[model samples]
Target: MQLEITGHHLEVTESMSNYIREKAERLKRHFDQVMKIHFILEVEKQRHKAEATFHVNGNHLFADAYADDMYAAIDALTDKLDRQIVKHKEKVKDHHRQEAAQLVAATETTD
Candidate 1:
């Protein structure tokens, strides 16, 4: 998956980019369908904000967090998105499994 990181008020440094990259890579463990991730980091006064937008299939999952520091903000946002990805994955897998079973039962009954 492609990861695009940008900053509004703060300079996008190598360490910042690496941190975002490292954090985003963990999402692949949840769903390999993740196509791209867009991260926007900005500092609003004393609050450091991190927002991540995950592009998967035709859907998008967005998570944002703000803290006194940028790294902490990114970490919190990553954790939030992690939970969302896991939940979505389970829902889709279960739904598809149920559909497949129903289809197999219907075909067997017809025969």
Candidate 2:
């Protein structure tokens, strides 16, 4: 998956880039089909904000958090992203199950 990191109102550092890349890679342990991740980091008025968008097949998941530290915000956002990915997975699975059940029922009727 491609990971794109950008900073607004802040300078990008190697440490920050590595950290984001690590966190983004962890998503693979949950859902391996993630196509890309876009991370936006911003700081304003002593508040650090982190936003992450995950791109999947025909689905998009997003999470954001704000805290006194950028690292903390990134941590919280990753947790939120995990939950969103899980939910999306469940929804997609449910949709396919429903479709499969309908097909099975139609075949049984014809038989």
Question: Which number leads on TM-score?
Answer: 1
TM-scores of the models, in the given order?
0.84, 0.83
What pairs collide in candidate 1?
Answer: none
lDDT of candidate 2? 0.90
lDDT of 2 by residue, 53-92 (tens): 8899999888899999999999999999988888888877
Q: List residue ranges in candidate 1 displaced over 4 A.
A: 96-111
Weakest ten-residue segment in model 1 by summed lDDT: 88-97
91 Cα displacement, candidate 2 (Å): 0.9
In candidate 2, which residue ranges exceed 4 Å CA deviation? Answer: 94-111
Alpha-carbon RMSD, each predicted model: 3.0, 3.4
> Model 1 over residues 1-111: C-alpha lDDT tens digits?
889998999899999998888888887887989999999999999999999899987679999999999999999999999999988887666577889999999999999
